[model samples]
Target: MSVAKKLASQTAVYGVSSIVGRVLTYLLVPIYTGAFAAAEYGVVTGLYAYVSFLNVVFTYGMETTYFRFANRLGTDRRELYDRVLSLLLVSTAGLTALLMLLARPLLGLLEIPPGHEQYAVWVALILGLDALTAIPFARLRLENKARKFATIKLVGIVANVALNLFFIVLCPAVASGKWLPALQPLVTHLYDPTVGVGYVFLSNLFASALTLLLLWRELLDFRFRLNLAVLRPLLGYAYPLMLMGLAGMVNETLDRILLPKWLPDNFYPGQSSLTAVGIYGACYKLSIFMSLVIQAFRYAAEPFFFAQSTEKNSPATFAMILKWFTLCCAIIFVGISLNVEDFGQLFLRRPEYLQGLVVVPILLLANLFLGVYYNLSVWFKLTDRTYYGTYIGAGGAVLTIVLNFLLIPLLGYLGCAIATLACYFTMAILCWRLGERHFPVPYPALRLGLWLLLASGLVGLGWWVQLDGWWARHAWHAGLTVAFLVALYVVERPRTAAPLVVR
Candidate 1:
């Protein structure tokens, strides 16, 4: 099969689980918003933000390291795997244990309330589990075991969704004599009514534990060998990747972490900064569709791109792939932006969260830029010019931090959204500039820009037409989406069909 076809197949397979899993995860947003106060949800948000940062630390870019060494013609795959897996096990286990030992001090440093230290501990454990699982997941990609990878991922997501339903919905309803009267006491005891935001972390920890059990095959396949000779070069390649990953994480998540701190003392009268953070975090979930696409593409694209790097026309192929990727993502951006009001209602179960709906389009577009950046970034990775990535990512991280600091205090969550867009845009442009110098790919820059411009205009037109109510808004957005589709078809149909007609 052609490389493009292979990638498309892999992306579809990965997307089945990723897209479904994210949709399932979206169910929890409503549950949390309904069951907990916004401030309480903020605690969940802050803790998870910390987990994102810690995950980068614990994994230390070993997943990419595995990919790099595994692809080398002369490397001993088993030894490389063993060495990497052994390093991960030792590092993550030690980190988890150390955190457990210093839980109290760590909690204090994170500004966790005295009563919420256990939440911090649970988050640390979850992060540790996730870090350990990263290597196995990477191995799945390395070996082209997409079926097993998707199955394991889907199972975990299903298990998580089931557990969430049991705890948050079914358990409560059963306890209240709405579902199962006989199991009331058991349900009530198991489902703490006052736990509120803590259950979000607890559900995640339980899910992680279950996922670890499901990864038994990949975990046991490891053969512990510390090959220092292989390790030396792998570490050199991976160190900058680690820096890039850290900076990327900061760019992606620092707004969640810093927004609370950057909030003015009296911004919300009686409510705390954490409260504001929770609202932003919950609203951010609306953009997970963009994240889902980016993730699925990454899963398939990394190995595919690396494998194709030696092909004669790989650079041209990459440029074409990136152009297509941006066009697709821009279309999705318009679709989502046009219908965010209805989509926001899916997760914002309570009235208070409706305020955050304003930021959804901004966050969605930011993620779209992020996806485009990822597609453009293969140039650096394939050319072994990874230092450019580190440079661009570090620059973006600085912008993220500065923007959040300046804007979060003044504009609240909207500022964070704008900052995210600016950060990703800067990274994409910087990477493209550096990449053109190192390995010029003739990306259809003008055509891609025009597509985005057209989509933006369509969405803008849709926004201006006041579709009176929910159903009307839905109809209008659907029509607008169709309009975008028709426009794309009109522009590309001749090129797409000419070859087929000739054949």
Candidate 2:
């Protein structure tokens, strides 16, 4: 098989774990929104925003560090894995204990209700378990155990979904009806309807615990070793990556965290801050189509980039991959944006939460930029200039904070969307410019710009042109989507001269 074909097959394998898993978990957005009020859902949204940041802290770049050492010349892969595993075990236990002990203070910082403090304990446990599992998962990837990697991920996601259904769906039915009267007391005792979003947290906790069982081999296989010789260099290589991950999380999730804190009373005087958070969070989930793509690409791209760095034609291959990645994202952006209502009907459960739908397209574009930035970021990682990643991510985080502070009060959730878009676009451009000076890939700038322009033009035309009937409107937008696809084909017509398989 050709190198390109092999790369694609591996990427597909990675996608099964990332894209499929995220889609399963993402399906819960509609269910949660439908079952709970916007305010109730907001509790889930806001708390998980903090989870994203804290997970970065708890994991502390051990996964990337593992990949780095395992791939390096003369490095003892087992020693490095065992050292990473040992370090994480210690750190995870300590962090979990600290967070649980200071639950009240942490809850207070988040403005969480006093009764909901159990959420803190649950989150701590979840983060700890997830952090402990990080190296195992990375080990699977490093060893080319993609099937095992995918199985574990799918198991977690499926377990989470099943648990969600049991707690959020069946428990409510058994509690309020006589259909399961024998188990009604048990259901009533375990599941409190008034607990609201706590079930979301509980489901996550249970699912994470279940995943640990599946990874027993990985967890138990490692020796307990944390040699200073290994630890020093690992930290040297990883600290900058940890900083990059933390700052990236800030840009990605700070809007959800800050939106409620900064929401103005005049915008919705009667509704609580959580209500605003719920709406924004639900709308943001609509951008998961883009997030899933970025995630799947990242999973496949990282190892591929590292392995290919030594090849003679690596730069040309990287450039080709970038263009193809751009094309995929452009197609996704156009498909999702032009067919916004189509997706809404499928996943958007509550009309109330759809108030922030305007942000969907904006956030899709933002996430696309974020994905492109990830592709550009290979230069820093490859050159051992990972600190440059820290700079770019930190700068984006600053822009994210400033923009959200200024815009959230004035524009509400829309401010959050705009801020995210600006942050990512600026970061992508900056990273590309910096990359040109350091470890450049000949990215087709004009071709990529035209692809984006075509998508934007289609979006604009769809918005401007009016159709009299609902059917007519969908038909028009659908036609525009087809036209975008055709434009893509025409632009890449030269490649199709030789069929992909030539069968």
Candidate 3:
């Protein structure tokens, strides 16, 4: 099959699980925001942000290392897999143990209340499990077992959502005598009236453990062999990748972690910083449509690009893929930006949390650039110029830090959103420029740029033509999205659609 067709097929399969899973997972946003106070939700968000950062440290760049080594000609695939898996198992276990031992000091460092320290422990466990499972999950991708991969991922997400609903929504009512008495005790203890945010992490830990069991086939395939020679080269390749991953993650998540500390004292007086963080985090979930698409694309794109590295016209093929990815992502950006008023209603059930709606568009645009950067980054990977990626990512991390430092105190969470967008946009552009020097792909730069400009215009028009009432506003915004898509299609019909017609 053509690379495009293969990517489409795999992405569709992956998307089924990703989109549905994220949609289901998104249901928990309402549950969380409604169940927890803003401060409580902020604690949940900050702790998870910390978890995301630690995950990068625990995995230590092994997932991509697997891809790099597994695809190389001279390597023993099974031994490489075993070594990487064993390394991950040891590292993650050690990290988790270390965290457990120092849990008190860590909680003290973060200044979380005694009651909420358990939340940190729950997050640490979940991240450890996720880190350990990363290789097995990557093995499924390497083997092209998209069906099994999608199934396991979907099931984990579904289990997470189910648990959240049972604990936060159903159990409370049942325990409060609003429902049947028969099931009350089953979850009465589980549904802690005061432990609102803790259950989110607890549910995630349960789901991660459940997912490990579901992936037992992949996990049990592990062996205990160590290849010293393989380890040297793999480490060399992955060491920079580790830096890239760390810098990249810090760029993506530092805001969530630092916003509370950085915010001005009077921004939301008398409330805990956790509340501000929670509002930002919950509202950010609205941008997950863009995130889900980008993530699924990355999963398919990385393997697909690696497999196609030796093909004729591979650079051109990659360029085409980037163009299509940008176009589709731009469409999504417009769709969401135009209809954000409706989408914001999904999680911002309270008036206090509605302030976070401003960050939605900023985050959505940042994710778009992040996706483009991922696509552009193939040049370094294909040409063994991975150091460029590290450099670009480091630059982005610096930008993220500087912007958050400057703006967070002045503008609060909005500064974080702006800084994130700026960081990603800079990273994407840098990657593209550096990739041109290393392995130039004939990206449809002019056309893709035009598409972005046109979409921006349409979004601007939607804002200009403000309609009254929810139904009217939704209809108008939907119409704007459709019109923008049709215009984009018309402009690119010859290049994108004519060949299909001729075929």
Please rank every candidate by TM-score, starting with the best.
2, 3, 1
lDDT of 2 by residue, 1-503 (tens): 85566677777887887888888888888788789988888878888898999999998777877777788899888888888889889989999999999888877766776987899999999999898888898888888788888889899989999889888888988888846877897987788887777888889998899888899998789899877775998899888989999999999999998887898875866678888888888889989988888877777778778888888878777777777888898888888988787677677788887777888988999999998999889888889898998999999999999999999999999999999999999999999999989986777877687778879888878877879898999899999999988877875877744322110
Q: Which residue runs does candidate 1 get wrong by more than 4 Å?
A: 109-111, 464-476, 497-503
Q: Against the true structure, what is each candidate's TM-score? A: 0.94, 0.96, 0.95
The collision pairs in model 2 are none
Q: After aligning candidate 3 to the native by TM-score, how far in Å is the CA of 279 from where it should be?
A: 1.2
lDDT of 3 at 397: 93
Candidate 3 TM-score, C-alpha based: 0.95
TM-score for candidate 1: 0.94
Cα lDDT of candidate 3 equals 0.83
Q: Model 2, which residues run further than 4 Å from truth?
A: 496-503
How accurate locally is residue 178 in candidate 3, as Cα lDDT from 0 to 100? 87
* lDDT, candidate 3, 331-429, per-residue tens: 899988887877777657777788778788778888998999999999888887778888998999999999999999888889999999999989988
Error of 3 at 327 (Å): 0.9
lDDT of each: 0.82, 0.85, 0.83
Best by TM-score: 2
Instruction: Report the lDDT of model 1 for residue 125.
Output: 91
